[model samples]
Target: MKPGTLHLIPSPIGSNTDVLAPYIRSILESVPYIIAENEKTVRRFLATQMSSELLAAKQFAILDEHTPFQDMPALLDPILAGQDGAIISEAGLPCVADPGSALVQLAHSHHIPVMPHPGPSAIFQTLMASGLNGQRFMFEGYLPIQEQERLARLRFLESLSSREQMSILWIETPYRVKSLFASLCRALREDTSLTIGQALMTEESFIYTATVGDWKKGAIELKKSPAVFAIQALPVAAGLRSNKSGGKAVGKPKK
Candidate 1:
């Protein structure tokens, strides 16, 4: 039998897979073994696209942070044996910011075919709704948790965004969302365009983009919600004018 492919499946970020492509569903149906960040989550996702019988028959291997690195090599045994296998995350694409990237790297080192299926990503979804500089943006993932270091990091990212005319995107743990927002409000200039997307792709989702001054007028309580924050780069003069007139700062032109 030919060497089986290692499919990098993109699971839904939210509770439902309504945003996933039809082909992604078909790919999941074809794979019998899945290397998941969390077996329960992957199983739940599979249940949505498959029959209960097929779901029960599917084999799973967990690959979260707690999993030992040395054990990763063994996870690919099924794929190496010519059995098509998949790598999935609790939400979104397995490795963009998840642990599944390690497996993908291993697959490449072994000359195994790796396939990526397009699906919904909270990062992209947040950018889409953020109305920021989507054409020239960087995903910084999570920021420093230490107060002083985090403040310094935020300043650096803000300055980088301003200088490069690029949007700086980052995330924080659910419980720390409010604190991060507060830090952003404190550290960023009044003119900088700040955006926050909460519970994206869901009914309770909220996305708002405005100047830092605007955000301060009446900041929404983030509570313990999953959120993504972005800062749009703007020219100094334009940003000043927007701050004065209560208007949006001009974002970088998509060229």
Candidate 2:
């Protein structure tokens, strides 16, 4: 029997399922075994995308941060037996800032064919709108929650971005959005370019790019919103500051 292919399926970032290519449905229909970060969400997505019948018929194995190393090896058993399988995340593409990568790595080691289907990704959507250097950017995922470690990481990434002229992309849970934004405003240079993409693709979606100093001046509320943040390093002088409406700081173009 021919080896079964491993499909890397992408889940919806927001309520918009239109981002998925038409071919994705066919791919989803082809596989019966799925490895997902959240089985419930994946199943629900399948039901919405195709049919409730598909959801009922499919088999799932959970693969998240809590999934054990020992359990991973067994998860590959179905694929090794020439059964087509898939990996999905709670949101966005699989294996990205998600534990699904381990399954992909294992699939590669066994020479199982791994195929990717294009779909919605919050990281790319944020970068596309960031107005930053999209050509070169880094996805740092989530920063450490610990204040000291998080501050050190912020400075390190900032220096790297400044030196490399690359955009730094990261995210935070809905509840911590405000805290993380506050931290960025404090730790990053005043002139650093920052883009905040909140509630992307949803009715409440918000995307704004401005200098750190500019962001500090505005009373933007990002609490309880899923968001992606992108920062572009700028020479302190080149990244000048401007005032918003009422003497509030705003990002000025790099000279």
Every model's TM-score: 0.90, 0.90
Root-mean-square deviation (CA) per prediction:
4.1, 3.9
Q: What tens digits encode model 1's per-residue C-alpha lDDT throughout 31-71?
A: 88988888877788888998888888888888997888789
Clashes per candidate (backbone, < 3 Å): 0, 0
Winning candidate number (lDDT): 2
Each model's lDDT comes to: 0.81, 0.82
lDDT of predicted model 2: 0.82
Q: Residue 107 in candidate 1 has what lDDT?
A: 86
Give a tens-digit lDDT track for model 2, residues 65-172. Answer: 988777898898888899999988788888887777877888899899999888787889899988899888899989999887888899999888988899999988
